[model samples]
Target: MKLYDVIVAGATGMVGRKMIQVLEERKFPVGKLFPMASSHSVGKRVVFNGKEWTVQELNEENIKNSHAKIALFSAGASVSRHFAPICAKYDITVIDNSSAWRMDPSIPLVVPEVNREKIFSGSKIIANPNCSTIQMVVVLKPLHDKYKIKRVVVSTYQSVTGAGQKGHDQLMKEWNEEEIQEMKFPHQISFNAIPHIDEFLDNGYTKEEMKMINETKKIMGDNSIQVSPTCVRIPTIGGHCESVNIEFEKPFELSDVREILSKAPGVVVQDKPLEKIYPMPIWAHDKDEAFVGRIRRDETVKNGLNLWIVSDNIRKGAATNAVQIAEEFIKGK
Candidate 1:
């Protein structure tokens, strides 16, 4: 068996670091691990495959020479836009975690459980779906396949980690009696939930909301499906939670819905409300699978189902999803 040479771009950041961690956790065969980052992050120590490694500076020459078969990119859009194509020139499969190229008509935005078939052996650039979109689609895909989904109304209670390390640090500063002046979000997020995630657009929806609506349609391969999302930021440091209401074309029974989700791949149904056994962010931290509960029939309309979904924003949302794309690609090869 030949080991694959893998490079994790932006290797010092939260998601990039987690990608390296997940690759080791999944025991992915790696011939060499090239941890790529900016010059400022260069020489930082990174542990992988049970050995200490140093981060390398990301540049045209560095990327071309790495000879990496796969590159996991979690750097922001500006970095990804510049470096991902350089990696592609070397014939590396770049699975990008940023919002960059997600809506590109030529690029396939993928959720492994829902649309792994979009990945082809020749694909050089693959876009991982948004953190919120990933978990919803994991649950929605199963229901959609069964009853034909018509619309989705989602309000995300996202963790501070979704804003990356800066957001997490800001929350901690406020929590530990420090004055937070300038940070990622517009306001402090210690105990209060801000009803905003990204910049607000003219349409009164945040860019985060638009990403959910548009990405959901693209990843699900259905433009006819309607999505309305409100993304919020909370002080939690681990997982993101969502309250989702779905409407289907066909009627569904609550029991049948639970049965369907229970058997779905990459989905864990935790709907025992009476036993105090429902999914929560604290329990979902560091967990890979999407945890779903609060399943019930929407009373106002026929063929409507309500659900609560939770998962680690950094793990399954970003790093794990990117690595899963690479894993499926390797499996097909």
Candidate 2:
């Protein structure tokens, strides 16, 4: 494979930092790396390919002038909205980690293992799904294909890190009994669960919750699949967990569901209820694969199932997913 010049946007953010780490850990072939960030972050250094690269302020001129072929953007939706098009016009494939273009009909929203075939080098922009949706879909895709998912109700236990480094700092400050700061999250995130995440819609559902509901349908490519989500910001630091109730179009046996997930790519079945070996955030931390366990039948409804899903929000949820999309683009898949 020929190495390509890549740009890491928002290099100072949590997910951006991990994107660089994953690039190095996966040994992604890169002719050069452009670490781009805001003006404040300009001149800062990020380690990549065993050496330090200085951060540059993101601008259309810089992106076009550098001739970067691929850019992994994690800055924010607004930043992506402004820069992704300019980069794409230069024939730069952008794998974005924000919610900016996920719903754009022209862009392919991808999770490599689930929908790698849907991706092509001709695709200029690819949206990585929300952290909650990414882990849920990894486990759901195989089952959806076999039994056909009819409806899904998911409640997420999301980590503080999902908000960013400021969220992490707030949690730490509150933990150490410092004066409370309420910037990253709306309310106190330490020893408290905030029912609200992102902005509230007219329907009373949060933006985060709706992302799960909407993104699930788009990524699964099944409009008939109904999804209702409740996203909560938990006190955890690494992984995000979900308690998912699923209703399948066809009856499924527990053993068969286990077998399918076990064989699915980027999925790890850790169900051993008797041994208490179910997946958890602490165990899922820093891991790339989605961890699934606590499997059992939801006997209240026919053809119903209950599962616990966990994955590192920073890894498989954001950085790794973005990099995987870029890899697919590079391979011309």
Candidate 2: segments with Cα more than 4 A from true spot: 180-182
| Residue 307 shift from truth in candidate 1, angstroms | 0.3
Reference-based lDDT, residue 260, model 2: 94
- My TM-score estimates for the predictions, one after another, are 0.98, 0.98
For candidate 2, lDDT tens digit of each residue in 1-333?
Answer: 688899999999999999999999988899899999999999999998779999999998789877888899999999999999999999888899999999988888999988887677356888888999999999999999999999999999999999899889899998998876467888888889988889999999999999998888888888899999999999999799999999998998999999999999999999998998999989999989999999999999999999999999999999998888778767773
Candidate 2 residue pairs that clash? none
Query: Residue 172 of model 2: what lDDT?
Result: 93
Instruction: State how far residue 162 of model 2 sits from its true place (Å).
Output: 0.6
RMSD in angstroms between candidate 2 and the native structure over all alpha carbons: 1.1
lDDT of 1 by residue, 97-122 (tens): 99998999888898889998898735
lDDT of each: 0.91, 0.91
Give the clash count for model 2: 0
Prediction RMSDs, each to the true structure = 1.0, 1.1
